[model samples]
Target: MTTNAAMQGKAMSVEEEKIQGGVQSLEVGLTVLDALTAHNAPMMLKELSEVLSMHPAKVHRYVVSLIRKGYAQQLTDGRYSLGERAHAFGVNALKRTDMLELSQRYIQDIQQHLNCSIHVSKWFADGAVVVQSLESNHVFNIITRVGSRMPLLKSATGRLHACFQPEHIIRPLLEKEWESSAKPEQYPANWEDFLELKAKILSQGYASVTGDMMAGINAISIPVFNFTQQLDHVITCIGTEDQLPEGQMQQAIDYVLGVQRQIDALFHPAAAI
Candidate 1:
């Protein structure tokens, strides 16, 4: 015979299972919203249904629920688009977006994989400034700190900025750097040489230095662009020549480029979709 206590325990277990699995209706409704968001324009019921691979009637039901919640809306022509509430949500999210915070996990991943120190730099009023640094497990002392300013022509991080940023923005800094450089002969001798160097860096999609910034230290830097395709940040990996040799340069570049693509996708989700 079934006991009353056993029945109640069974009911509780089913309830817990439902909680763990989440509300299916809510999930479906959010999927509808995602379809609209990714579409980035008003979509008809038939179009959205096709995109989600669901029946039109079922898609309309979820769309109705989203409309009631102000996450979506219907136009006079019966096309559906993101609502005012959804726009506000996206605006708020953009306001809170921080490049340094977004790159932290990727930075840690690369440091662990390459066993090399990583530096993240952002352009300040003067030039590229190190905003974040992560040290590898190896016992070498990395001289770059959080507030250190990286040179425009002398460091890999700086060259990356020069490659992507507007010529007007970087030209003054480049001239000043050339004038102030202790070893002027080591850099491009004239404006034509500077242009050629920039062209080469752009062609390769990254900049690199060996025993240039600091004797014994080699570094590679890649640029990260925002949704509007502006230079957002520069990520640099540093190590001794032995740690990152010429033979292994391509491997390190691949790792950094992978992270760069991820960050780019995050900034430009519509393009990614």
Candidate 2:
């Protein structure tokens, strides 16, 4: 006689095994969809079967089901490609992706690799506001925080924004900073000086500052643009002079720019090409 507890245990074991082993048909369907996306063009039945290493009849059955569900379409030439439904699904997913949320993992990866503080900033009505930050274990007493508004001319992140953002949008902020700055002499002395600084930052495709925002601190910043090709955010890495000396600056810059490329590729895939 099986006890009630023993029967319950047997049922639980079966349920656990079922959960571990997912539906294989769904996995195969997703693989077919992924292949279509990778090919990025219409494919004949034979081509898809060859790519997926599956029997033509089986692939055809899946393709037919996908067509019925609107996940794929058969072209007039009998080749298959992603359908309107798939496109709509992708667009909807992108619409819900927040830049800061999407970038959190990348930011943490860089921080761990470089063992320095990293932050991301977005342009607000007033200036570039730090929206996210990751601190390094080795660094302490860093001043920048989530709400910190970086100085346009005194910080690497600010300088990058000044260089990439529209002139009309940033000019007023620049003037305001200049007027309110206690040590105006530390910034560009004249319009020509400011232009030279801007040109240099644009030419280099990034911005760097040494002991500008704080004594003995160094930083490098890169820009991330959205699908519309507008400056969406800036990522900056901060470290003490000893940790990011001239010898190691190039490596830090590479790590920072690598994250920028990843983000740009995600949002602006065409520009990457």
Over the stretch 1-273, how does candidate 1's per-residue lDDT look in tens digits? 889999999999999998899988888888889999999789999999999999999999998888888999999999999998898899788657786678778878878888888899988887889988888777774658999988877789888877766778888878887787788677665567879989999887889988888888889998877646778888899999887776788989888888777887888877766
What is the TM-score (0 to 1) of candidate 2? 0.74
Native-referenced Cα lDDT, model 1 = 0.85
Name the regions of candidate 2 deviating beyond 4 angstroms: 1-35, 49-71, 74-77, 190-192, 267-273
- Sliding window of 10 residues with minimal summed lDDT for model 2: 135-144
TM-scores for the candidates: 0.72, 0.74
